[model samples]
Structures are given as structure tokens and as C-alpha cells.
Target: MVFLVCLIFCFLAPALEAQVAVRDTVLTVRPGDSLLAIAHRLLRYSTEYTAGELVDRIKRENGLQGDAIQMGQLLDVSLSYAELLDQPVIRGTNFAARGIYITAALAGSRRMLTLADALVAAGGNTVVFDVKDRYGNLGYASSVPLALEIGAGQRAPIAQPAKMLDALHRRNIHVVARLTCFYDARLARQRPDFVPFSREGPGLWSERGKSNWVDPSLPQVQEYLLAIVREVAELGVDEIQLDYVRFPTEGNLADAVFAFDPAVVPKDRIITDFVTEVERVLEPMGVLLSADIFGVAAWGREADRRTIGQHLPDLLPHLDAVSPMLYPSHFEDGFERIDRPVDYPYYFLLQGCQRLQKLATEHDVLVRPWIQSFDYRVTDFDSLYVTEQLHGAEDGGARGWLLWNPASLYEIGFAAIKGFTDSTAATVPVKLRFPKSLGMDLTRPTSVAD
Candidate 1:
């Protein structure tokens, strides 16, 4: 009998351990609290289950017969892998990204390995690759169905995404995928109904004779972008940085039209709602989300914010970080009482970063400004210029900074970072602040009405 019982125990042990591995948390119901609200609040970190599905699980787990729950009742909740990781008790380092942007061409080439080595040697730990270009082409071979149907993945530069990501991850380097939204010329051309209409004529609206922008307020557009985001996140990137997230600004805006009227929905709300939807999708997968906004948007002017559909205040709630293109060269002279803004890279960067930092703090997000690298306007652009910009960003309380050079030529910029490191680099432990999401406050549970 003892031998038979011991043999049977071995089979049961595996099943018991599997059950033990399923994590659960106990929540005390407050006034007006319901099972659905709890599920929605925790849904931000759920990867597999939807809120409604999770509610069913909660009911079955807690042995509740209905959706109703009494105040102060102890309820057992199943926690997802992402939600468990997001618990305040579980902590990890949030890497301060001292980084550079890599074009898809450079990222796919053999030079990528050499560039990674050089960047790591300089104490840089982040690399933002252009996963989707401005022309609406994917940088890698994507399996997303819409991408395949639209031929978006044709001529993909980064043919072997897994191999490239593995090489970077092995070096303890954080990888950020940069995706361009809305201004997808290829996508607009393929789906003519998605393109902006011309108020002046019946044909599609074009910016400077180029019909590159799609209506951002459309549901199909948002779903398509989210699908791309999901594919990239599953590839194990550290973050997703969205660029061109606003409406077109360069050309005949007065004659341009959108699917949604600006009067009823408003432009900022359209952008904000889209970002909120993205956050809902990404947060549950444990991926960081950020947006690149115009540098002038930092001033918080209503006209500038509405025109671009990038009101920082509305967008911050859904982002882990907000990157302002704060390159001083991009600023016009006499804009901020600073003539020859390019000559004052440090001042402009500091000012713009500081302004954004204040707003970021309210939302518990980081401000990682994009610093200039190329000599677009300044004649004296050199290694020192790069170093000064770094100092200014640091002084402005920026968490980190990213260098932007379109051609991926950063020899001078790299030298500046090396010199700057020699003078001021210090080893700091990594830590990720388990921040509050836009969902219901799980930490401080309130009444259901809240």
C-alpha cells in the first residue's frame, strides 16, 4: 500500500504545483465597487484576458454567483503575468536611455554590430531603430496580415529581426522601435478612402503635392497601427516610440479634410483617444509607450497643440515618456526671445525639457528629449556642441537624451558622449517606478463610483 500511494503522489504533485503557480491577490470591496470595475482596473496589465473574460474568471474563482459584491468583502483575484510584474512589491530598474537613432538601412547592414560595439563602449545602452519609416514601409519582415495585404513589409530592411534583437539584448542594450503614424504615404495610396479629402476639390488632399497623410481619427487606421505595435512588442523590444503622431502641418492645411469633424470630436481629443487605446493595448503587454511631439508644443499654446493634434497635457496620461524634438536648430529665431536659436543649443534644449518635465512629473512619466546631431543650421557644430546639449538636458532634469542624425552618422556625437562620460559618468542602479496607469487606481481602491 505504501509503495502504491507513493507512486500515485508523484503524478498528483505536478498538477498541484501548476495550480500553486497561478498567482492571486485579495481585494476588499469598497462602497459601490463591482467585479467589472476591478477587472477593468487590473486589465491594464493583462496580456491574455479581456476585461469581460477576466470578470468571468473572477466570479468563478471567488465562488460568486452574480456580478454583485458587497462592501468590505474579501475577493480573490487572479493576477496576470504582467499584472504580477507590475505589483509595487516587484521592482526593477528603468534604464535611463542614453541613446541614438539608427536608420533602417544601417540597422539591417553588417555595420550594425560594429555600431553597437562602439555605442556600448561609450556607455550608451539604448538604440532606437526605425521599425516603420515615414513612407509607410516596415523596417522588418512583419507577419501582420494587414501589412502583408498592403505590401507594407515589401523591401523590408531588417530582414532578420530576431537575430538583430538578440544581438542587441545580449549586450544589455535597450531596444526601442520607432514607428511613424498617420503620415504613411504608401498606406494612404493603397487605401484611398483612408486619405484626407480636399476641401477645395474632390480629389485627395496633398501636402506640398504629396498625399502622404491618412486620417488619424479613423478606427481602421488605429486598429492597423495597433496591429503593427503588437507585432513589434511580441518581438521583445524595450519600448515603442511613435513619431509623426499628429496631423500634417507643412502644406495646404486650410483645404485639407478629415473623416471626423474637428467641431464635434476636436483634433486633440481624436489624438488623445487614439493614444489611450494604444496605451490600453501596450500596457497590458508590459511594453513602454512614448510619443515624439513638436518642440513648439512644449509651450502649451492652444493653436500649436490643436494644429498638430499633440496637446501634451492630454497625451501624457497615456505615455510612459514624452519625447520633444527639442533640437535648437528646429526652432525659429525670435521664437522664445532667443535669436539664433541654433547657436544656443544648450539653452533651448534646457528650456524645452524643463517645460515638459513639469508636465511629465504630474503624469509620472519621463522626459527624454531628442537632441540635435547634424549641422542643419549651425556652422560651429562639433563634439563640444554635442557635449553642451547633454549637459543642458541633464541640468533640466531630463531622465535621458536621444541623439538624432538621419543618416546614422554619429562620429562627432559619439565622441562628445565619450568625453562627457569621462568627466561625469557615474554608475547608478537601475529601477523602474511602477507607475499609475490611466485605469482605475488599483493601489488606492475607491468606491465603484470613482
Candidate 2:
């Protein structure tokens, strides 16, 4: 019997390695210990499930139909790996995830450690790395069958992702792995059937001089994206952020043919369902999920939401946080009746964050806007300009903010944050606080106007 048990344990070890165990403990019902209290204590920092949900689970586990428990009665309780990992960093009591964006190449290079230090010195504690990009290349080696079969891991940059994650965790830095969905050039090229067909031409439809995007409504595409998320979450990322999760807005959109008819299924539903499915799969793994949207989503325009397949009302409820790329340069002149909107960095971010935060609050989600760090329109773009945007976001009640520079050159941003931290710390303690609890509610307004 001992020999048989040993063989069985060895056989199941590899399979069990991929699964997160439900940590179970037996506890005696003590004086003043209510079921709700116990659930909250077990899942205080957990973003995956609520106290009520856990209460129900506990009742089910012990086969008790009633919430009442007798003193001295023993019960078995469980906590998830996700709950265990959801913790506040040592940087501050209130953990606001002030973060910077890093590309896969930078994340894989030796300079990544130096960049992490620079971020910390700037009073930032989060790093968002693009694990899968528009080109459909995985930054690290992947074992996902579809990714391997399609050569998505051909240019694996971060050879040992686990080691890198361990290094970042040691530094108290939150890691958000960004995966570019839908707009995948590599997947579209190798799997032409997944991409949109051209009504006006013979070839697959693509953004003009740009990449081809997969159809979000397709089950295969959704499963493939979820597979990537599962693989990344398994590698121990703190969060998984989806970029370009929406439908394509550029190119000859009128001439493109998707797998499903937009008139029947509607683009918004397709996008929302995909996000919901991702959340369902990721929540159990103990990792938070987020998505990046066009800055215009904050404006609450129905036409734009329909065009891009990202309705804040539909999307926000499913995400732990929503990152709107609120870059001033991306806005055109005369937006919000302000001429040369790019010139007024503070005004743009303040307005955008105020609108987004209000809507996100209704859905029990966090608003973490992406601020522009690169110079584009403003001639005197410098540290002061970055500082102004940061001020606006904070003033507008954003939980945290991320700096965006495509090339990863953020010296201006670094200086801006450091200056703010130094100046603010002299007067009062400055701490960025991450949300204590996050919940998903499907009962949001159908539209922003509603």
C-alpha cells in the first residue's frame, strides 16, 4: 500500500503543479466568531471574491443550510491562492500602484533591473510589461499549444519569466502582464480564417499599412486569448491587462466582413462577453484583470463605443481596473470647447479622470489612467507638464496612474513623479492607495447616458 501511494503521488505531482490548491483548515467555532466575520478575516485583501460568496461556500463545505453555528462545533474552511497573494506592499500602508510601462524587449534585457530601481526611486511600485504584443509574439517562452503551433513564441525575450517575477516581487513591485488581444498580426497571418475578410478586395482586411486583427466574436479567438491569460497567470503575475481588446476602428471598416454579422450579435456584446469570460478564468487563479481603452471612452460618447466595441458601462463592471489612455496629444483641437487641448495637459487629464472615475465607481472598479510621457504636440513638454497631468489625475480622484511612453523613455516622467513626491512629502505623507476591495456587478447602466 505504501509503494502504491508513493507511485500515485509521483504521477499526480506534475498535474498538481499547474493547479492552485484550495488551502483548507479546520477551525472550532469560538465565542463571538460569526460566519461573516470569519469570511472577511480570511479574504480581507482578496479581489477575486466577496465575503458573502465565501460565506455561502463555507456553508456548503460543512453541509450546513443555516448561517448559525454552535459554539465548539468544528468546521472546515478554505482560502484560495488568489486570496493569499493579494497583499499590500511594504512601500506604504495604503497601496496605490503608481506604475510605468515597459516593453517586452526592455523587460527581458539586463537593464530591466535598473529600470525597476528607477521606478522605485520615482516612488512608483508597479511595472506593466507587454508580454504579448501587436506582432503576436510572446515575450517569454510559452507552452500553450496554440502559441507554439503558430510560432507565437518564436522570439521569446524573457527566457525565465519565473525568475524575473521573483526579482520584481522581492522589490515590492507589482507586475501587470499586458497582452495585446484581437490586433495580432502573427495570428492573423498564420490563421487567415481568424481574421476579417475583405469585401472590396481578395485579401484579408487589415488596418491601412498596419496589422491584421482577429475577430473577437469567434470562440477560437476568445479561447486562444484566455489560454494565454491562464499561462501568464500560472507564471505568477500580479495582474493581467488586456490591450486592444476591442474591435478595429481604423482601415476600411465598412468593407470588412467578420465571422459574425454585427447587425445580429452587435460589437459591444462581443467585446463585453470576451471580457467577462477572461475575468471568469483569471479570478480563480488569484490574479487581477484590467484592460486599456481609447482615451475617448471617458467622454461617454455612444457612437465611439459602438465603433470601438468598448462601452464603459459594459466593460468596467467586468474589470478590476480600467486604464484609459488619457494622453492629451491624442485629443484633437476644440475638444470640450478648449482650443489646442494638448496644450492644457492638466485640464485634459482632470476632465478625463473625473468622468471615468465616476463611472468606474458605479461598477466597483478602479480608474488608473495612462498619462502621456512622450512629447508630441506641446513644444515645451518637460517634467512640469508631466507633473501637471499627475496633479489632475489625483485631483480627479484616480486610484493610481500609469506613465506611457512607447519607446520606454521616461526620464521626464521619473523626474516629474520624484519632484511631486519630494514636494508633497515635506508638507504631508504622500501615499498612493490601491483599492481595498474590488467587486463585479453586471447591473450597470446600459449606456453612459442612461
Candidate 3:
């Protein structure tokens, strides 16, 4: 009899453990259902409860920690909701196979919709929005006094940052905040000492003729950017993508000079210091940090490092991900050998990403290359080229990619990718594939990048 009981107990344990106490329910609150009303309705059959008692019970039931409900949030009021009230809710980070950028202004203004609407238009799932722009302007009003002082505070055309985040979180869309670092014209003019200046002259700026850029060497510069990163962190952004992380590259090198005091620091040290400081601030917060490096840097040559101050091995340690700007037009002659660099987008993009993949593998860092979505000097930017580049990035072993169109307009390129069918709904998954002919590794690295 004792042996029979033990066998029964063993058989029942697995089934009990497998059973989830709460069913996966998506409750849509009707227009008339108040917090109290819903509770009374769900508990009407219970003999001991009054309607008034049911209302309070319902508030407790739905794990409505606060007495509030939005118009149409599909609440997951399962048995777990009550137990998980104080804990940080974990949401999915599944991004769409193809994603696009939406300016904060556009996202807020006429294009504004329930977080659902915006996701559907871009083929759904992932959103890359501007938290801070090239001009150092914040998309939403900020609590930081320095942000407001520099005119960084502006209402995101979308109006509600928290509400938007909650909506997107519910839909499982990965939200990435694009923060433009070092390219602040407004702050540069306001704080001239923080800007990079030419060593040739007391007042000369770099050749890009852009008079703005925070001196990367300044400790205060890193502090200022960290302040912004922290503010966005509180909003629950999945990732913080640092743009313009490099020194000014297009300017006349002969005339243009770095203002960072050489007696105090070395050039390579300055770049790494800024990245390390940013990582130091962000690491404790548990946020993913990524930096954009010029495509040429992946080649691991001295000239590339001199031009952009970006050394792959040096930067790999400080970043969770590195995005190389592999836009074909940005390459020089003999890249893919199609005569005009613009004419041969696929060749340069594929080769550039392949080289970057190899370099990143050596360093053991994640590579997510930025692909060209717009036509530069050439006029033929169709679906075929866009798909080809996407395939190339995947083939080169990149985890994912970002499409670049300075104007924020994306249509033909988005349509070209396969697997996704819904273009009018809020969130949907799209499938993508890398051709078998091209070899790349998708596995996580066993060792960290140097």
C-alpha cells in the first residue's frame, strides 16, 4: 500500500506543476464598466458578496494597484497580476524583421495614434524614436534643469510618454531610444569651451563647418549625456543607441584640430574614456548601450582610426552592440568594383558587412550594421536592392539591422522585405532569411570583446 501511494504521488506531481493557476485572459473593459462594475459582474454568482463589496473586491481582484483604467488596454488580470503588482513587468523584446525611424515630432503630431497605430504602419513590432535629436533637443519635456536651459525640452508630438510606453509594452514591441550625442549646435554655441576647435586658429571650427560638438574629452560632457540617458532610462527604453559618437570627420583635417588638451590626455584615450564613462553610468541601470561607428573602422587600419578616432577593439569593451554605417555610397573606389560606388549598392554593402562581421567576431562583440535605405546620388533605390542589403547583413552574421533615410520617409524599401502581410494593424511579426550561400554565425560569443 505504501509503494502504491508513492507511485500515485509521483505521477500527479508533474501534472500539478504543469498546470498554470491563471488562464491567459485578455479582458477588454467595456465603455460602461467602471472598476466597481466589472468586479460586481465577475463576482455576481457568489452568494456572500454585495455589489459594493464586489467593487472593492474587483479592484483587489484585477490587481488594480491604483484606481485607474484606460479606454481599451487588454489587461492581463490573471491570478499572477495580484502577486506581481510591485515587481517590474517583463515585456517581450521581439522587434520586426524590418524597422524604420520616426521623428518625435512626426510620432506626436498628425501621425499620432494609439502606440498600436504607429507600429502597424512600419510593418509592426519595433519602434526606433528620437528621445534626443541632433540639435540636442529633447523630444519630451524633461525634469532636468540643464536640459530645459539648453532648450532640450519639447513635448513629443505624441503627448504622453508613459502612456505610449505602456501601450507599446503591452503589444510586445521593442522600443529603442535614439540619442544623438556630441552634435549639439545649440549647446556648442551656448558653451563654446565644450566645443571642438581647430588648433591652427584660436576661433576656427572643423571643416564640416558645423560650429557645434561637445568636447569628448571633458568629464562634464559625459556627465551631461549621462543625465539624458538616466532620464530616458526611467521611461523604460529597451536600448539607448548613441549616434554621432565619433569626432568630426568631414572637416579639413589640416586646419581642424581637437580642443581636448593633449598635455592632459591622448586622442585614443579621450574617445575610449567618453564611451567607458557612458557605459559606467548605464551599466548599473541594466540598460543596453550601443554606439555607431563609421563603416571603414571595421577594416582595422591606422588611417581609419586617425580619421574617426574609432578603434574597433577599443570600443568593443564599452558597448553591448556596435553599428557600422555600411551605406554603400560612403565607400571609396574598388569597393565591389561596379565603377560608381553608388551604382553597386549590394556589392559594397555585402563586402563591408562581411569584413565587419569578421572583425567583430575577432573582438567577440555584437554587430548590427546600419544599411542604406535612401538613394544617394543614384536614383534607383527599389525593393530588390533593399532586400539584397538586408540579406547581406544577415549573411554577414549581424543580429539585426537599422534602415537609414535622413528624411524619415520609408515605403518602397519596407515593402520589399518578405514574410509580413499586415500593414494596417498595430503589431505583427515578420519573417526574414539569410541565403545559405553566404556564411555567418548567429550564436552568442563565448568570450567578451576586448
Tens digit of lDDT per residue, candidate 3, span 1-450? 432343334333332311323323346777865766655444322211233444555456567776578767555432211111111234323222245667887554434344345445545555678888887778777887677776667544444465455545555566678888878776787677777667676884754777767777677777788888888887777778888887776667656556555436656677777788778877787777788888767666687676566766777778877887888777765542334565554544555567676656666667777878788865666765666667667656776677777766666645643322332322211222211122343221212221
For model 3, the run of ten residues with the poorest summed lDDT: 79-88
Q: In candidate 3, list every pair of residues with a backbone clash.
A: 108-157, 108-158
TM-scores, all models, native as reference: 0.74, 0.74, 0.68
Alpha-carbon runs more than 4 Å astray in model 3:
1-98, 110-124, 154-158, 204-208, 257-264, 333-338, 362-364, 419-450
* C-alpha local distance difference test of each model: 0.77, 0.78, 0.61
Instruction: Give the least accurate 10-residue stretch of model 1, judged by summed lDDT.
Output: 82-91
Candidate ranking (lDDT, best to worst)? 2, 1, 3
Instruction: List residue ranges in candidate 2 displaced over 4 A.
Output: 1-95, 209-211, 424-450
Error of 2 at 275 (Å): 0.6
TM-score, model 1 to reference: 0.74
Write the number of the candidate with greater lDDT, choosing between 1 and 2.
2
Clashes per model (N, Cα, C within 3 A): 5, 4, 2
Writing each residue's lDDT as its tens digit, candidate 1 over 101-162 gives 99988887767878888998987878999999988999987888878988998888675575
